[model samples]
Target: MIVIQAKLIFLNQEDKQIVLDLMRRWSSCMKFAYKRLLEGYDRKTLKRDLQGMFDLNSRYVDDAIMKARSTLESARELGKSPKKVIFGGRDLFGKLQKRHINGKAYEKLKIRWQEKRKGNLYSRGDKSKKGNLNTRIEVRKNGTFLRINVGERKYVYARIEAGYKKNKRREELLQEIAESNIPYSVELKLKNGNIYAYFAIEEEYPEIKITKEKGVIGIDINAHPGNISWTEVDEKGNLISYGNMPMPELASGSKDKREYFRWQYAHEIIEIAKKKNKAIVIEELEIKDKGKRGDFSGRKSRRIRHSFSYKSLLSKIKTLAKREGIEVIEVNPSYTSIIGMLKYAPQYMITKDISAAYVIARRGLGLQEEIPDNYMKFLNALTVEELEELKEHVKKTVRNKHLKKKHLREINKAIKFLQSLESEPERVLKPLYGTSFSTYDFWRVLKVAVVTPLSPEKVPRDFSTLKELLIQGKWGDP
Candidate 1:
């Protein structure tokens, strides 16, 4: 049978108290019935015994016990042994012959249980007790009106009408039902003085699969504007440019930090790829000087050092990728930027171009190419403005024409580093520096001086010595 999950909300205190009392009475009645059964009375005969003792009308008492037995049997099959069953003594055989309780009365009972279930009842000095008696109840929803009568005077009346609806709301509800486990189980909870009864539905796990082919994309993480670049290549190793998304200037200086934006964008892209059933290929980044002071001059260095958010972005991307079923492959990022620069080396500068071209040529011929430290020096010397200008130049010049083989190779190589940065920089950092450092650590680890124990009288007594020790320990420099 299809079961719908529904909740009941109580309107006032009077309604709430009435429901609580009904539950207590019902629980006591069930306990008495069970006690009789344990005393060797048959299940049906026990109901007759309860009918006589409670002065309950014979028909009502018999029906209540039978219904309680059925509920108990179902609960047992479902691996649950209910402590007690709740229903009205009078209503079971009276006018409203509903099988399962619902509506306002059910909600009221639910709330009373929730409030009395928490904590020890009495203080150490007082003998007053705590904790309400345990009782089990069921609610069934059939129509707009919830009708339940617990006893002769205690009854609950409420409406089960929709709260609000948007376009396609029912469709969304249907989807949720289809995806969810049928006959879902939830803990019925009620809070005193609260207008609504709460049900905490257990989370259901769904099966997930990746349905598309594998694709690799490069990501570059930054402090200001976090960027990710994608390069889609076909099976034949040919480049596909339509898939690339480059972020040239992601404002890195904002105090608000852009980790949230990066997480949102990455998840968006990853989800798109996941829905398409494609695997992602990414480059590995090696971030160095993670727990170190900024290299900028004077006070500006200190100020700039405080603004890194690299670690937060990487963490967010990794979590999202896992949820999307993206397979991230890490490739070495060494010399990617340098190689990319060399590939675009200007034709006007023949000597330098040839030197840059030679690096790609050797790699293409399956020969090992040595990376010079000068490349790093060159990169370090290029100001942020110059890097931006170079990016603009490449964008403007490389359009509407075929890129040279040398330049294309370099760009592909640099793209690997960018991919690594975008996908999982920690993977790259682990191999290169033996430690994963990101822009986020600038605030967490490097901003403070490491405390050193002193023999009370041997205080360093100088800020420079403290700074030197901190730098030597790789925390930061003055």
Candidate 2:
């Protein structure tokens, strides 16, 4: 049995209430089932010895009895008497049989439960929240519904049901989650700024994969004046072809909305290439220097900057590649964009033409070999007439160097702040200092001071903000 966890985000008060009620009822059912098991005439004490069993052993009826007895003795030593011991339902019990199985089963069951609960809740109410109700349930085919109780409160129960019939919808959601590379865990936590029978599916890590591969492909993300520059290579480290793709009409913001469509196109291309069992090579990008301004002055520049999800795009490519057993590698992007332009002349005029260059460079590198120096030099010298074009290209290449430097400085400052926080032990700053402090403690420290500081709350959020700031800064410090 596998338990998969999911989150259910309710839209309105009514929906929220319905979900809460369902969760409580489900918990009560589990409690009821546990009580039944306790009262059975099996000639064994369920409460006396069950608690002493290891989690796995206690999952079984007979073993639970033995464990309870042992636990009772231990409790006596601490001046406490063992009380009623409740067992989880079949699904929960099966989950406890093994750690890995328990986790997976929990998720599957959670997703399924949330999905079913959503339908039931929606049927009862007309008005909901801003977004559609998102439900996550775990699925385990053989698991039976059960309930458990603790003291006067009954909790932890589930209703078994058939799988959802919407294969396409499920697949689409799964794809979205996968592409986002978001690994989440279901946590029973507060919702809507209040404590309730709500579960939070929190993202554990940024769904991004950074790899070091021999070949490098340059990419210039665009919304207006759309274009991409690419350079391909063969196994012998020889440039095969280089070019760019232009979005001529994009300069006026008409093509701004096409970014998602472009991603879809790129995704399709990658998918087809995957079928041929090929590896993808791309540039390694770090958006550290993005906070600095750029040439695009007005709101249009801001919109263009906001529109590109380069990280997400790269993330999708890596994820799809991994699923298909194709390798995705990143090489120093450095000056790939500029170099691509110089190498592929007529091809560099537009962005779309870059795809041809990408194929050539990918082939030339043939899984091993650094991007050649000549290409880098060519890129360094390549010039663009449009300030937006220059800024975008430079932002992709030179800006990385700035980010790399700032990141190191931030780390040093963060260490001091963390040590101070740790030294003042009784400050009750745990909430202020999140659980995963080590990952982004420095940024968190910065955020406490500013309402909307230059830095963002998280890495991805920061990246987006920084891009805009950088582009905006290009006009003036304001």
Q: In model 1, where is the ten-residue run with the lowest total lDDT?
A: 119-128
Instruction: State the displacement of the C-alpha of residue 381, model 1, in Å, after optimal TM-score superposition.
Output: 19
Off by over 4 Å in 1: 1-8, 14-139, 142-215, 221-223, 233-278, 281-478
Lowest summed-lDDT stretch of 10 residues in model 2?
118-127
Provide the global lDDT of candidate 2 against the true structure. Answer: 0.37
Scored against the true structure, residue 376 in model 1 reaches a CA lDDT of 28
Tens-digit lDDT track of model 2 for 153-254: 333444322133323444344335433434322223223333222222233334333222433443344444455454544344445444445544334444
TM-score on alpha carbons, each prediction: 0.29, 0.34
Model 2 per-residue lDDT at 454 = 32
Give a tens-digit lDDT track for model 1, residues 1-478. 1223334445666765665554444445555665454355676677666755654444345444654566566544333334543333333333334525578876655544444332001101111211111111222343333333545544565433223332244324423532342222212223354322222223333343442133333343333332444434333323333232344333553545455565566676676556545444433323322233322333322323343544445455555666655655444433433332332222112222222223322222233433233322332232334323433444555443434333333334434433344443443333235335443221111111121111111212222333223223222232
Instruction: Give the Cα lDDT of each candidate.
Output: 0.38, 0.37
